[model samples]
Structures are given as C-alpha cells and as structure tokens.
Target: MGISQSTLFRELRRNSSPAGKYIWFKAHDKAMERRKRSTGNATLAPN
Candidate 1:
C-alpha cells in the first residue's frame, strides 16, 4: 500500500478483470503468473 500512485494505477490496469473490476485474489494470481513468466525468461551465462 506504500506504492506510488502511478505504480498502483499501472498494476490496476495490468491485473484488472475482463469486466474492469479489481479483485485481490485475481490480481495476486495475475501478478504471480507474470512473475513466473518473467523468471522463466532469465538465463544464467556460463562463467
């Protein structure tokens, strides 16, 4: 809740339901899915 207003607005736009409603559980699931997808794209380079 300490996030900036712009950050909050961005998340709301990103995780809002199809009906344009914001639900905590749905938003959390969406965020988790996005995090998982992003992490999957990270690859470590061999030293």
Candidate 2:
C-alpha cells in the first residue's frame, strides 16, 4: 500500500519550519553531490 494520509500529514507538519527542513535538505544534497564528484574525479585520475 502507501503511507497513511494522517501519518503523511503529521510528518509534513512536524518537519515544516521557516528555518528548518528545506535548508537542511539543500545543504545535505550539495554536500553529497560534492563528495560524489570528488570521488569520481579521483577514480578517473591517471596514476
């Protein structure tokens, strides 16, 4: 099935904030992307 409607709403409300979830998400995404790019570059470098 899927997430219950009430549970989804509760999570949205709980996580919502003017200075919270979205900022953290963007920061985390940027960090992960930077790490992946660095790792890929290292692998492709000539020894």
Candidate 3:
C-alpha cells in the first residue's frame, strides 16, 4: 500500500456494488473485465 488512504477508498468505491456492499469475487471479476476491455485481450501481454 504505497497509495494514500483516499486512493484506496476511491478504488473500493469504484469496484463496489451499486448496493454498496463489497464482494471480493465480484470486484475481481469487474477488474478483469475492465482490463480485458481496455487492453483488447484477456491479459496484459500484447498479441
């Protein structure tokens, strides 16, 4: 955690559910999905 408290809070806020509960699996899925979309691949490696 080199990040500041506010940065951590912002990430949690972004990945948290609309109902305002944090589910670990859902958050991980959301992150992976976003990663895929942003990189155009399932992982970070280039084609």
Winner of 1 and 3 under lDDT: 1
**Candidate 3 weakest lDDT stretch, 10 residues:** 37-46
- Please list the C-alpha lDDT of all candidates, in the order they appear: 0.89, 0.63, 0.88
lDDT of 2 by residue, 13-32 (tens): 55556554545575566668
Candidate 1 collision pairs: none
Q: Over the stretch 1-47, how does candidate 3's per-residue lDDT look in tens digits? A: 79999988988899999999989899999989988878464656778
Better of 1 and 2 by TM-score: 1
Residue pairs with colliding backbones in model 2 are: none
Q: Sort all candidates by lDDT, best to worst.
A: 1, 3, 2
Comparison by TM-score, 1 against 3, better one: 3
The candidate that achieves the highest lDDT relative to the unseen native structure = 1
> Tens digit of lDDT per residue, candidate 1, span 1-47?
89999998998898899999999999999888888878465678999
How well does candidate 2 score on lDDT at residue 45? Answer: 62
User: Worst lDDT window (10 residues) for model 2?
Assistant: 15-24
